[model samples]
Target: MIKFLIKGILRDKSRSLLPVIVVATGVFLTVFMSGFLKGIFNDIAELNAKFNTGHVKIMTRAYAENKDQVPNDLALMDVKKLLSQLKIDYPDMEWVKRIHTGGLIDVPDSFGETRGQGQTIVTAIDMLSPGTHEVERMNIKKSIAKGSLPVKQGEALISDEFAERFGVSLGDKVTLFGSTMNGSMMFNIFVVSGTLRFGNTILDRGAIFMDIRDAQLALDMDDAASEILGYFKVGVYDDIKAQQLQASFNTKYSLKDDEFSPQMFRLVEQEGLGDYLKLANSAGTIMVFIFVIAMSIVLWNTGLLGGLRRYSEFGVRLALGEEKKHIYKTTIYEAMLIGIIGSVIGTGMGLGAAYYMQTYGLDVSSITSNIGMMLPSVYRAEVTPSLFYLGFFPGVIATVLGSALAGFAIYKRKTSQLFHELEV
Candidate 1:
């Protein structure tokens, strides 16, 4: 019986064409919007992970409290040993140590006198690790506008904007003047190896990148780190998994008696991030909801239009001794067929477009540079499992619901009235 109904729907263009088109259009929008929004959310989360926080981060209890200050005094001790143990225990995750500090970069002239000065936020990460693609992962190499990656000791990368502001260039001798973890003044001379632009206003303004070993020596924090960042193999943030990991880690390393205990934090739990992530997710939900509601109304109206056009057909069926219920059920089955066909076509179109967007993202660098936010310039679509069936929810539900409501008129028509109405 279902096969017969599908055959009838295929043969009857008047009954199937408009509804199929309507459903396809609605589902297309649904799939496209969902993928687009997912892309934006994932982009924001990934950028956050790459630049500031990872999926999970481990910090000293005191440092977590005063994290905004980038307090190196409460940095983790014996970081190398802890990292090695973590690698052995959790091979699925990649962990890296980082030191965050601030200092004055002085570009010296031929006479060794200060030619330019700029305050910088210094970040130190593992550049020499043969096993890790930290430089590529962070996109530092791609962001470089001049020179190349640091290849030797005492070499560093400064933000291109910072270099321009300070009248500095590649291979320029620059001296970093900052205080050590113990409150003693420390200085390190480095030759600028490259100029990079991260597209982040704050980071690009006065950011300096150095090798982790160099930072450790200069900051007087040997074998210690301000924070340890951990990421999953997928290279995307998973809030639920991060929370679970944090719970498990914190439970095992309870701070009951120790004031200097290490604490684990999910990406969203980091400073000033919880609200931002929440807002972004909430906006995506609202967008999907809006699409569903709008599509439902559109398909609903299409169903009503199709039902009205089939009024005479319904009357003729009832006149031929067919039950009103049977006619209504047939209409629903036909709607289902249309919904399925439309959804398949629409999902295919949406996925194709999404793949394109994902591969070659739209560049928004011009706008991002002026906003002074930590947003990436390229916006790409992120295709997920939901993209396959996301359209079906709106397509089937809206079509079936609209048909069910519109088909109610069949029950109201008496046999005599149906026959009389069948005339013209």
Candidate 2:
């Protein structure tokens, strides 16, 4: 019976072609949109983890509240001891200390007079430690436009754009003028070992990277760090796991009453990101739901129209002693076959397009240039397991449902009406 139906559908394009096209179009949109949205959300989470927050971040309660100020005054103290304890307590994670501050970069001329000055945001991390992963984690080596990674004390990397604006080059001396953690005047000279282009407009505008030890000395923040970042050994952000870890650490070490006490926060808990993640998820769900409903209505109408055109044929079948239930079931089976074929074609096309996007990505640098948030300029689609089967829901179920609704009219025809129709 199924083979006969398949042959019939193959022979008669009118009965199958239009419905298949509709299902294919719907499935394509469903699959592509699912992959695209998933990619965007994942990128947001990963970028945040790499640049700002880690899987989890620890800071003083005061610093967590006023983090926007880069409050080194409220930074964590005795970080070495804290780091040792963290490594012992959480063997499954990697902990690193980081310092963030803002200061002026003053370039000096041949006679020692200031040549040019600009403000910059400075980030210091463990670049010189043995077996350190900061350089790889931030893709610093790959992003270098000129010169090389800092290999010694008092060496640093400046943004390529900043270097150009100031006419600075590798091995040139630049003085960092900033206040210490105690709010006193401080200045230190560093050799520009490399120039980098991070591809982020905001960061490229004015940024500097230096060794943690150098920053500690320049900022007078010895034995202190602005934040302690923790990453899972697996290198993926798991919100549930992060939340559990945060709760455990805070319960054990954090003091609610002491503003200076250390506090732990998951990535989702910081930078108003929890709300953004919720909104992204809700948007994807609503989008898929809308696609399913809209496609169902369209395919439903197509089935209804096809059924109207087949009234004469159905009447003949009924007149030949065929049961209405059997005819209706056959129509449903035909719809199912059409749905499967269309879905396969559509899924293949969608995955192909998504793979291209995932590889090349769509550049949106112009659109995001002014945005202060840490968003990548190129947006890529992500193909996940869910995307493999997401299109089938709208493709198969909607097609079958539409056919069932349209085929119900078969039972409504009376025997006398059939005979009258046959006479006509």
Candidate 3:
């Protein structure tokens, strides 16, 4: 039956091409979008994982409120002490690190000087130690133009964007002058040992790195750190564990903690590109509907008269004592065979599109670049098995319905009462 159906359907190639085109197009679009969403999310996650908010961070609540909030002195919020104790008490925490402030970097008389409120933020970091593995120790140091990641006193890494803007090069002595956490002004100079490029315009434009101790001294942080950064045992990580740590802080140190407490650090969830989620799902639905509707109209006209033209075959077969059921079965078998083959081909094309996207990603930026309009660039698009499945099912369903309807209505099948007409 399947072999016969295949031969019959292929014989009338003109009648079956429309559904194949529709299914193939739909599959391509689905995979295209899926690839774009994946790339953007990965970049964001990489950035978050490298920055201070590794797995989880416990900080002064004020820092959470404002990224610019530089508590001049490290205020001992019991939460910091408690997190330290948990690492010792549990042997499950990776060890906590402290951070203090980010101030405007004041460059001396080299190229351009930051006299007033200029560019740059001098954030304090303590994890500049060599051989540190808290987040794989992102090697922004290698991308440096002047110096390396700050580990010692009087050494600062300038952002590449800033260096280019000011014409500062590697190994140049630069001055950092800004107000301390105490609101008292201070000036410190360091050798430009590293210049790092972030690929992002914003971070490269004004970001600067300094040792935790230097930042504390420059900002008058005293013995306190602005916020406590944390790393946990490799296996003991994730939201649930983060929540448990949060609970421990709130339940154990809520009252005992003075300056810092539950309000301090948020459960540092990694940033991911979730922009695809914002796209209207109805968009795909509407496109598929139009495609289906268009195919139905085209197929209906093609199949209707086409099936009626086969009336002579049905008439002769009936005269030969072939039952009506046999004719219907043959017609359905032909239609399903065409539908299944087209579906297989369509699925293969769709997966190929998905794999291509996995390699190069969607080019949405072309829209912006061509039109000169401001648009957010995305990397990978969101994809799922369901999208391909959706495409294949519609082709099969439409094929069966179109074929069955045409066969049933136009078999030119003579009713017993119509025998006289046939004889005449």
Candidate with top lDDT is 2
**Maximum-TM-score candidate:** 1
For every model in order, what is the number of clashing pairs? Answer: 0, 0, 27
Model 2, runs deviating above 4 Å: 365-371, 420-424
lDDT of 3: 0.57
Worst 10 residues of 2 by lDDT: 365-374
Candidate order (TM-score): 1, 2, 3
lDDT of 2 by residue, 1-424 (tens): 7888999899889899998888888888888887888788878877888888998999999999999999999999999999999999999999999999999999998899999999999999999999999989987998799999999999999999999998998899999999999999989899999998877776888899999999999888999999999999998888998888998899998997999999999988887778888887787788778877787788788888988888888899998988999999999999899999988888887887888889998888788866777787788999877777888767888889889888898899787798788777
- Model 1, poorest ten-residue lDDT window? 287-296
- Candidate 1 or 3, higher TM-score? 1
lDDT of 3 by residue, 46-99 (tens): 344446455566555544545445554434444345656767755766644555
lDDT of each: 0.83, 0.89, 0.57
Instruction: Name the candidate, 2 or 3, with the larger TM-score value.
Output: 2
